[model samples]
Target: MSQNSLRVVWVYPDLLSTYGDQGNVLVLERRARQRRLDVQRVDIRSDQPIPTSGDIYLIGGGEDRPQRLAAERLRRDGGLNRAVANGAIVFSVCAGYQILGHEFINDLGQREQGLGLLDVISTRGEGERCVGDVLADIDDRLGLPPLTGFENHQGITHVGPNARPFARTRIGKGNGTGDGTEGAYNDTVFGTYMHGPVMARNPHISDLLIKLALDVNALPPVDDRWYEALRNERIAAATQPS
Candidate 1:
């Protein structure tokens, strides 16, 4: 988290880069650089070891097989947990989100252990997948605007006492836990189901990540007019999708 540069690690792109979740990293890098902050972006594939040197780490959505493989590889590699222990920030989506928890149902329908970075537990839900637009109110504590994006996961994640919900679902089945919660966050780990590459649809969230990573109260402003316009358009559609 140096003023000279911030390292952003993209984890398991070969496996977990689904649902345009890679945009989260792109937006993070863009915002930082636009503010004249240097960024060292590293794409760490599934086969390689994750590095603890990063200030922020990003994981994306993927199918069951890739998710299972990524979880296994990460748990074995041990760098992610070490990074978290060192206070590095993490943002994950869908399958990436699920595998950050204590455990998740794998492609074989067997229980696969997660990194335990998040205290939640994940299980594949029954019936239909939770797909299409999502509209949610972010946790009041974050004091952010409404969340608008897309959800297409069968994951039913239960937030344990150690963690809290990231948002409340106004539309679409988030977490599919029947609790109307959309995501989970604890300490430095954050996970969500919404995909419009999420941060691209909600630039404030990107700013939050940057601030947290830099351990700063605020970030230098970057142009967000385009991001705001997209967020407004999506929120309207999610509220009145026809």
Candidate 2:
């Protein structure tokens, strides 16, 4: 209820933690501890019932089958949608991101239902997989640093009118189209394809999510010079031609 205490629900880690996405959960925990905030993480597996009242809900990337399975389980469990409706901060990446949209095409070229939390749709691309380092400028209003990460996905996501892009790509292909835009954001739900365990690379975004989860205007600061330096280095590297 207060900034002093928070709860995070990591959804289906076994199925959705590909590409070190579990690091996102660790980043949130570490950042919260650095600010002296008490945070508890609860993992909700496929067979478990999702808690409807967590402050933050984290869903990460997975392979096609796992992604479909996770989506199906979440649909049946039926807590995530209600939690988001109640203002819980939801962060999803890659396949997890796709699963939050209206629908996503699986590896078999079949359309699968999503949670419909974001007004976006992901379709399987016919060409090469978009895989590389990415640097994106976060929305200015969010007061966050540029996002840096690795993107490896074949699903090209298209954002609908109801949802806004979380950031604009500065380098590398985003949403698998070399588009200037990347990710999708609506209210408390954020869906992105960045998979350098995005939170570990963009701590400011993590902090912002924490603040949102706590319903606070601001949170205590933690030293981020190292993180900033790493981010800038990666951005510069990503922009350089091979």
Candidate 3:
């Protein structure tokens, strides 16, 4: 565990990558390189044993059956819980978000157990799928930029008192029918439904994760003017009057 080296565990990509969530890992790798850090990505599949510890962990969206299977595998493995206890930063998206909770209602209308990593629960909605661009305000204490990403999910999540909402939604449906809140957060663990491989669009979030992984309060700056401009443009379009 050298200070310059970071180990990132990509958890079950084969099962939970329906929304191109691997791009989130790519964003983290690229950001670490920009800051002269060495990043090693470990992909944990269904057949493999999850590493006991890592600097960061990424989990992605998935279909109903795969999500259930992945959740069961993770629960049986027990490595992720150890890593989280050791302060690893976890970023999960969409179905991954749901699976981290105590339980999630599947597409078949049956309740399934989850990993119980986050103090949250998810249930299917009755109307149209909540799919579209999303805008959210990050916690001010984090010093991160406002978040913008694409969300496509039907599970309405409710955060418990032990955890906090990751962000407040400004546009589009978030956790529980766009109740002005987006995701769930507890310590270094983050669960969100914003799926455009979220980190790719929100570099500050990536940096924040990196900071946690490295156990540092600050990181070397990287110019993101282009990304900022593009993100702003997209946010403007998404927020426009319909």
Please give each candidate's TM-score.
0.98, 0.97, 0.96
Q: Between candidates 1 and 2, which one is better according to TM-score? A: 1
lDDT of 2 at 27: 94
Identify the leading candidate in terms of TM-score. 1
| lDDT value for model 3 | 0.87
lDDT of 1: 0.91
lDDT score, candidate 3, position 149: 88
Tens digit of per-residue lDDT, candidate 1, span 80-191: 9999999999999999999999999999999999999998999988888888999999999887899898999888999999999999999988889998999999879999
Model 2: per-residue Cα lDDT over 1-242, one tens digit each: 77598899999998998899899999999999888888999998899999988999999999999998998999998899999888899999999999999999976679999999999999988898889999888878787878899999888899899998889998867787556778989879999999988988898878889888877888877888888888888888998996
What's the true lDDT of residue 199 in model 2?
Answer: 87
Q: Where is model 3 more than 4 Å wrong at Cα?
A: none
Which 10-residue window of candidate 1 scores lowest in summed lDDT? Answer: 215-224
User: Per-model C-alpha lDDT, please?
Assistant: 0.91, 0.89, 0.87
Best by lDDT: 1
For every model in order, what is the number of clashing pairs?
A: 0, 0, 0
Q: Give the higher-TM-score candidate: 2 or 3.
A: 2
Ranked by TM-score from best down, the candidates are 1, 2, 3
